[model samples]
Target: MTEYSAFKVELTEHVVHVQIDRPEKANAMDAAFWSEIVDIFQWIDDTDAIRAVVISGAGKHFSAGIDLALLASVASQLGQDVGRNARQLRRTILRMQASFNAVDQCRKPVLAAIHGQCIGGAIDLVAACDMRYCSSDAQFSIKEIDMGMAADVGTLQRLPRIVGDGVLRELAYTGRRVQADEALRIGLVNRVYADPEALLVEVLDIARQIAAKSPIAVAGTKAMLSYMRDHRIDDGLDYIATWNAAMLQSEDLRIAMAAHLGKQRPTFRD
Candidate 1:
């Protein structure tokens, strides 16, 4: 039970629940957050017992986005050399981007259970998830436009695929809040619940279901899906054919077949 400064993590029945724990500050992404998240998701990736993950906020809001104090600190570190400042800024942005990249690269399925205000960088966070679900009270925004900057993280890149180009452009350009129903309509969220409590209950159940599946099958599916994002259909087919050539021989496949023939629920190893 390792503790974290910006998050609370728990593992139950092969599912990991990762909560942004800074409710008092609306779970703002500070320096600690940017660094700690990469570590947390990496741990999730390496732990075989973690078959699925659910990410959510602790209290009122999912997040208020990047903490202004962190921005101010970065600003304070800037000096008179414009070239040096540019290099430093690029490094900082890339570091922040890697935090979400870790979530995207995790082998386990990552599900976002959002509630309240999921704004700015929080949008980037959930954009990296495999699936998203929210409560009726959830309000999402691509808020960097309101802050006088473009979103430089995963939101601008990953969201176009999730919400489609036109809808993503409207949200990113306008910085308007999309309520839960609209989120569902635009394919941003799979489902919406009456409240956060109900949202977590159902989303966790979904994670449990996914966790019950053969880990090898799930990981291969996720791998192929991620590969297809940048590759052509033919390339993806070739890659998967090569992948399954080795993967199909896994013992879990035999276990799954036996369980199916026996008319019993499959129990897979971690």
Candidate 2:
């Protein structure tokens, strides 16, 4: 139920639908967008009403990347001292990156539905999601190299693991556009639908399925998987072992077993 100028969040049947609402500006991330995103994701982490999340844009384009106007403002703020300016820019980059990191850290699974163009910051945004789906016509690019800068957000760090070593390097080095079919082939997206409307429908359907699961189990799974993403197998096993020691006490397992035996659907608490 949080209202934001950059995003609209809807909590329906335990799934949080979050749409970037600046379609008039191609949903470009501005200074406000950066700050607001952090708040949104932090709220996601805290809210019990949300069991899953689906994120997309409000119109034809998912996003056009960071707004040039915001970049210009940042450039203007770089005062005379090169050393001080570099330090300030580093802090700014870290702050912006945290916005996406918050999304990565949320307990609820996040699914992205993309259409039209999703470039630069848009790609970084989706890379943080648990799943990504797109329209057949959607296009993506890591455009920072073309702009004479490296992508300072989570893309370079995260996308490599999602897409793998070779593909990530090529995309980062070239700044080329990846059309929907190619994205599907390269594993950048889970699926490509016929259109944006259909993309949202299917993405939300999947989100609803995840929402129907036990929240305690779902959150533990997300937390464990994210932890395992950067840890060794033995380490992950040990971590999950320690985790479930306490988590196994949840009433969800008993409820799930009863529902299964009764041949009925179980309702999970928020």
Best by lDDT: 1
State the lDDT of candidate 2 residue by residue for 1-270, as single tens digits.
Answer: 667898888888688898999999999998888998888878888889889999999888999999999999999998999999999999999999999988888889999999999999999999999999999989999999999999989999999889998999999999999999999999999999999988999999999999999999999999988998789999999999999999888889889999999999998788
* lDDT of prediction 2: 0.92
TM-score per model over all chains: 0.99, 0.98
Q: Please give the lDDT score at residue 63 for candidate 2.
A: 92
What overall lDDT goes with each candidate model?
0.95, 0.92
Best by TM-score: 1
lDDT of 1 by residue, 1-270 (tens): 789999999999799999999999999988999999999998999999999999999999989899999999999999999999999999999999999999999999999999999999999999999999999999999999998999999998999999999999999999999999999999999999999999999999999999999999999999999999999999999999999999999999999999999999999888
Model 1 regions more than 4 Å off? none
Q: lDDT of model 1 at residue 49?
A: 91
